[model samples]
Target chain A: MVKLTADNIEMRFGERLLYRFQHLSLAQNQTIHLQGDNGSGKTTLMKMFAGLIAPSSGEINIQGADSLPWWRRNPLLGKAVYLHQHPYLFEGSVAANLSYVHSLCEGDKATIMARTEQAAKLAQLDHLMQQNAANLSGGERQRLAIARAWIMQPKLLMLDEPTSNMDKLSQELVLTLIKDLQKQGTGMLISSHQACVLTQLCNQMWKIEQQGLTSTQHTPTMAKYSNTGQSQEFSYVTAS
Target chain B: MNDGWLALIQQALSLLFSLDPEVWSIVSVSFSVSFAALAITLIPSLILGFILAFGRFPGRWLVTNLIQTLQSIPTVVIGLLVYLMLTRMGPLGDLKWLFTQKGMILGQMLICAPVLVAMSQAAFTSVDRRAWETSRTLGASWARAVWTVCRELKVPLLMAIVAAFSRILTEVGCSMMVGGNIADVTRNIPTAIALETSKGDFAQAIALGLVLLILSLVLNFTLGTLRGKAEPRSH
Candidate 1:
């Protein structure tokens, strides 16, 4: 199973320390909900795990990654797919964006193409295949970004505020995609300030508060509320 | 006077259309030299620009400022420096490139590289950081990620190239100083125009002038169309 482990990681910006944690590990079949206040460096932490940025003072090791060439320094990159809160869509059609990761995928051409078509359909973007990704609305852009990641079928995925700009219908669509990924045993680290439909899927919770990180095994009560159609109240209690 | 002007214009057009050997040779020499300079300088200058924009290292600020200063230095000054280097007593004198097209190309490369580097650096600096992050997170290699970013800023990078080409093509100072305006050898459009106009031979000068003007119009209009089509990206 693919796994990421960080030890004695301390993040700081110039002179101001953001947060410090002693030990953390994310592995396959683990679904984590990251919680923090605004400006708590949730995004920065996720980016660090994705190899987009270096930690101020720590080493992060990746297990079960392919042996990279000597010139390729960080193995964490491409091992974990990180989705930004406001996803960036390339200057091309929706179809182009969906197929961009095809070359990076390990499958054969036909399999990759089939996965691309499936992602487009699952994201409900098949109708807009020829449309320019730049012209897509915020919700549509998020969907397209997730769909692009879905085509990769990554071992680990980090979603930073995945449903922030999404509506109810769009959220449902994304939820279904994430559920499918979970069923396929993809590890996920999803960051959200408050509990939402997506967070309910998490079996563990990580909260960053007052320059410290704490982890706990979380049994989501919202699933029952969701079933009983009282999720609005559950969301309010968890948010506070 | 109007009749004289009309006759000169007619003669210029005729020389161009008929492809008079002398006029065409000058045009050919100018293009060949300038194109050589641009080709030799393009990739290295762009790589330097990208490093300046993204890499953090000691002396980066000093290098950036030096390049900005180089962009503003007069082309004639650059020509003088190149001339000294290629002179008989200078360090590079053994190669004996002075008064030749090689000398002209060397002079023009010095004039062209700064503009390309500075402009491309600006273009790369203005690129969205998310572009790089997204590409890397999507499993693109570092080289591929950089290529993707460059593709996104293709219009601006192209503008830099066009600007550098125009500068080198139209520069008479470097060509005249280093090349000594040798006929059919180092005499480019600008240098030829200067020599012909000095001798009151207006027809050939006007013909070469017309070529430069047409080239300028074509390059600018093409860049304008590209700029117009590149919609402003939103976050």
Candidate 2:
């Protein structure tokens, strides 16, 4: 099955054109990691592929549907979930938050609870479900975000900085979930500055630089070589 | 007048609870017109504010500054400006909305639209960009993205509405001039206060004042609750 394709997608921010994409595709069951300096349009690229944005000048065909320039939502897209760097948690119970935008139909109370339980187990968020999502710690937030995506059973999963707020242990758990997703034939795209995200699990890694995306590989020297060498190369940071 | 304090207190209490057809008329009219005007401006201001804050359109700053200046223009000035164009002799005279509830609603919308735009824009602008990006990547449509942003900023939006409501409710000049404070017709809280005080009905004036205070309190309480729950990426 064709996973996803963004053909010649161009996005402009005012006079500055941000990205020009030509033939980017993800195969079913493949994992791709996106990397970039701050404001290099990594998030924009991810959002474009996620179908959240209109490319200024191109088309994004997903799962065989003709790419739409305007807002496009599909029931199948629910089969693909995007977890933002900072997940937008609704004001509600933990279970309610987990079910947000997720269309798990015809399920009884027990089934819903079971699925919720399973998702929490993968994200290790079971203990925190009853807690107010607003008060969750950073690590806890990431876990809940992933757990929500996990419950949706998306064929395509995209995560932006899933472990930015987590410690080594939490990051390891996130990576483990990615491994499971790839094993289950879910194509995953992760945008991260962290070296760990571009693991052996990811078949390809790409980086955004000067308004363009170039293929990158995180060798063993990823940590020591990444930001330290190009400290001055990217002086501008995207204000959160 | 002889029992000044007692009479004032009684008069105030009476004006508050008496709820004569006139008082009820005024109260209902006030709410209806202000509510109508607010409803009319809600979507426009929201969309304008959203685009101004988040969109990369040219001359966006000019629009923002112009709106800010318009917001600071006094309510009386707004009433005068509209009164001119809407008068029997003015351009849009055929509508015959002058001194009518609809007229007042139009005038007040002019007053409140800016507040709604500036405040709501600030609120929406304050929402984390991640929320927008996340919603976008989820393959949500523009409408869905806007709805997501609105939901995320619902607390602020609520507060902005209350602020606009309270601002219009207490302004005497517009309701008086534009609504003409017609007895048992277009009279509202502020206009009623003016009429009662001018007619030496200090007791009634005090009563209307008390009601206005209570209304303001309710509005504030609602805004406070929404602000509390509107956790905008506090984490």
Candidate 3:
């Protein structure tokens, strides 16, 4: 079992401190929806979790392994994957792009092909498997990027604004897939503005603002009136 | 002008087809020296280019500046300095490189190395950093990462080499000053053209000059095509 933990972390870029958090831990398979306004530290914190940026003053520890590299520190980084807003695609056909990622491995061709298909199905990208990825539409391209990330069999999946370009149906498919994947022990961190998408799937919505990150405790009582007239339950709006 | 051009073209074609041993020898020797110098430049420039692109050191800027400055130093000046060094009483006098094809090759290597380094560093820097980081994260060592980048940037790198070779092959001043146009020995196309033109043998010089222009054009065209092909594909 892999647990993600950060102890008293302060993040800084150049001479400016972005934000600081104390003891952020995910003990189980949790789907976290990070909600924040633009320029708030949501992306920054997600980047830190993805091991793309190291914390200025803190310790990120993978509870099981002591000396693994930062990526390995969180299994998501090793077996997990991060999909950026503008995902970088390799230059080639979909087959070439898929095969290129697997080419570095010592595995058999069948294994690679099977995993590619499996990922394509999970990400609802089976239709465009043969098309040149560069020629895909915006939503198709985002799904293709999702398919690419899924092919990695990540223990942790972090997405920055995934499905921002996807259609409503595609968004539901992705959200359902994320929930299913998380249920099977893959933790997901999705940063998106679609609050309605997460109302059903996300166990918790962590909001980030100029102040800091705050955990909204999701008790069963809160779930009863999610779509009802009780809209004033909590201060859920963050503007400016 | 048309009559003169037609006559020059006819004469050049005849000279080229006559199997004149002098033309053949100079062309052969020039290619040999140019290719030799180009081969010598490849390793040092690759190493230096990789360093300049990726390695950070205290004197990195200074070293790059010096190399770029050397690139602009006229070939004649390079020849004169080399001529001095390899002269009878100079530091490398015992080696006797002056007035030889070896001297020409050495001079061309100096002329081409900096160009290769500058172009290659630009090519390498243009590679995507994601590929670099991915290879490293996947357990490929530093050497492997560099090899991957090189493999991906092969076409651009080849174009740079071709451009360098073409430049060295067409340059006259250094080849003349150092090779001394030693009739059938160190004489190559450009230096021979210079001598032929100076002696008012416009026919022979025109033929050689036209060939030089053709070579330069072909190399430049190939470089442009290769660059176009390699750009969108570069990671």
Candidate 4:
């Protein structure tokens, strides 16, 4: 199983400290909800795990992956995929973006082509394949970004505020895609300040507050809807 | 006087259409020398530009400023420097490149490199950071990722190349000093134009001038089409 572990990690920018965590490990079949307020380094932490940046002081190790060649500098890259808050879609049509990522994936030609088509359909972007990705709506852009990663079927995925600014229908669409990936045992670390449809899927929580990080077992309170959808009951519980 | 001007224009067109050997030879020399210099300097200058834009090292700011300063120095000054370096008593005297095409190419390289580097650096710096991150995270090799970013900035990078080529191709001082403007040997369009004008051969000068004008129009229009196609990115 793919795994990532960080030990005694501390992040700092100039003289200001961001956060410090003693030990953390994420492995396949584990889904985590990373919670923090604005500027609490949520994005920074996700980028760190994605190997896009280095922490001030710490070692991060990835296990159960093929050995990278000497020329491949960062071992953590391609190990986990990180989606930005406002996803960056390449300059092209939706089909072109999907084809771009499809070229990077390791699979037979036919299988990858099939996966690309399936990803587009799952993200509800099949009809918009010929449209310019730059002209896509905010939700469509995020969906396209996630669809690109979904083609790879990455072992781990980090979503940074994936649902923010998304309409309810778009959020539900993204939730469906994430739910499929979870069923396929893709480890996920989703960062959001408030509980959303995606946060309900996490079995564990990591919260950053006052320059410290805490981990806990979480059982998210699911909203129960009536047939008329007029009244709802809310419940909250957590296990330390 | 108007009739004299009309006759000169007619003669210029005739020389060009007839493919007059001397005029075409000078045109050939200009293109060959400029092309050689651009070919030799293109990859190295772009690599340096990329490093300046992305790599962090000591003296980076100083180097960037130095290149910016170099871009504005007069071509005549560069010609003089190359002349001194290639002169008999100079350090490079043993190579004996003085007053030769090699010497002209060397001078043009110095004239073009700074333009390529500075403009390319600006283009690279203007690229979104997420382009690189997205490529790397999507499992592209380092070289592939750089290529992708270059693809994304193709218009600007190509404009840099065209700007550098135009600068070197139109420069007269360096070719005159370092190449000696010898007929059928090292003479180029700009130097030939300067020579023909001075010798009252207005037809040949105007012919060469037309060639430069046409080339400039073509390059600019091509770049304009490309820039028009590259829609402004949203994020």
| Highest TM-score model number | 1
Across residues A19-82, which tens digit of lDDT does each residue of candidate 1 receive? 9999999998999989999999999999999999999999899998889998788899899899
- Tens digits of lDDT, candidate 2, B105-204: 9999999989999999899888877677556545455687788778877888888888887888788787788888888778988888788888987876
Please, what are the lDDT tens digits per residue for candidate 1 over residues B136-179? 99989989998999989999999999999999999988999999
Ranking by DockQ: 1, 4, 2, 3
- As a whole number from 0 to 100, the lDDT of residue A76 in candidate 2 is 32
Report model 2's TM-score to 2 decimal places. Answer: 0.82
Tens-place lDDT digits, model 4, residues A92-190: 789999998766788899999999999899889999999988899999999999989988988899999998888776777898889889998899999
Q: List, in the given order, the native-contact fraction of each candidate.
A: 0.74, 0.46, 0.00, 0.63
Runs in model 1 lying further than 4 Å from the true structure: A224-240
Clashing residue pair totals per candidate (backbone < 3 A): 0, 3, 4, 0
Kindly report the TM-score of the first chain in candidate 3. Answer: 0.78
True contacts kept of 4: 0.63
Each candidate: RMSD to true structure? Answer: 2.4, 6.4, 5.6, 2.2
Give the lowest summed-lDDT range of ten residues in model 2 chain B: B133-142
> What is the model-wide C-alpha lDDT for candidate 4?
0.90
lDDT of 4 by residue, B1-235 (tens): 6999999989999999999998999899999999999999999999899999999999999999999999999999999999999999988888999999999999999999999999999999999999989888888888888888899899999999999999999998889999999989999999999999999999999999999999999999999999998767785
Q: Enumerate residue pairs that collide in model 4.
A: none
Q: What is the lDDT of candidate 2?
A: 0.73
Better of 2 and 3 by TM-score: 2
Q: What's the CA error at residue A218 for candidate 4, in Å?
A: 1.0
* Docking verdict class for candidate 2: acceptable
